[model samples]
Structures are given as C-alpha cells and as structure tokens.
Target: MADAVIVVALLLVAASATAAVAQREPARQALVLSVLGVVLAVLFTVLQAPDVGLSQLAVGSALTPLLIMLSVRKVRRQARAKDRAR
Candidate 1:
C-alpha cells in the first residue's frame, strides 16, 4: 500500500513537471509550476518527510508562482509603456 502510494505520487510529480516545462506562456507555465510544486510536496510527504514537504508546499506552490506572475506582469507592463513611447 505504501509503495503504491509513493509510486503514484512520483508519477504525478513527473507528469506535472513535464507539463510545466512544455507550457509556452509564462503565466501558463507558472500555473503548471504551481501544480508541480504541490505534486512534489505530496511526493515528499509520501516519502516520510513532512517537514520538507510543508516547506516545499509553502515555497513551491505559493511563493514561486506568485513571483513568476508578478515578474511577467511587470515585464508586460514595461513593454506596453515602451510601445506607447514609440
């Protein structure tokens, strides 16, 4: 039972990571990355590392995606400003 859960979690992590990498847009990629982070947290928990999983969930699922989205928004905003100036 435990082995099966671990294997499933591992597979989910792999699939989500691949999905994240395959995304073309930064926003979409960030969304997929957030999902990947949650999947990774699950994998860590299944591996019996709740401490690591908790931190991963907080950082990967939340902070990383938020930062990426903010960065994308800032860049797009700058590009728009530049276009306006032109």
Candidate 2:
C-alpha cells in the first residue's frame, strides 16, 4: 500500500511537470511546478524520511514556488516595460 501510494504520488508529480512544460503562460506553469513540488514532498514523507520530507516541503514547496512566482512577475514587468518603450 505504501509503495502504491508513493508510485501514485510520483506519477502525479510527473504529470504536473509535463503539464507545466506544455503550458505557455509563465504563471500557470509556475503553479503547476509548485503543485508538483508539493506532491513530491508528500511522497517523501510517505516513504518514511521525515527530515528529507520537511526539507523538500520547505525548499521545493515553499521557496521554489516563491522564487518561480517572483521570476514570472519580473519577466512580465520587463515585457510590459519593453512594450511601453517601443
């Protein structure tokens, strides 16, 4: 049962990652990646690595998502600025 849960979680993460890659919008892609990260973190916890799981949750689920969001925002701002400058 545990192994099955882990496999399902991993599959969800993979699917989310693929969806993120297929998405054209930066915000949407970031959101998908964030979801994938969270799913992976959950999988880690289920696998009995609490420390690794917490670290993954903190870095992947939180920090990475924030960074991605910031980067997307920055890119959008830059694009808008360039458009205005034209």
TM-score of each: 0.98, 0.81
Q: lDDT at 83 for candidate 1?
A: 100
Best by lDDT: 1
For 50-77, candidate 2 gives per-residue lDDT tens digits of 8888898888878887898999899889
The root-mean-square deviation over C-alpha atoms between each candidate and the true structure, in angstroms, is 0.5, 1.7
- TM-score leader: 1
Once fitted onto the true fold, the runs of candidate 2 whose alpha carbons sit more than 4 angstroms away are: none
- After superposing candidate 1 on the true structure, give the runs of residues whose Cα lies further than 4 Å from its correct spot: none
Give lDDT tens digits, candidate 1, residues 29-51.
Answer: 99999999999999999899999
Q: Which pairs of residues clash in candidate 1, taking residues 3 or more apart in a chain or in different chains?
A: none
- Clash pairs, candidate 2, are none
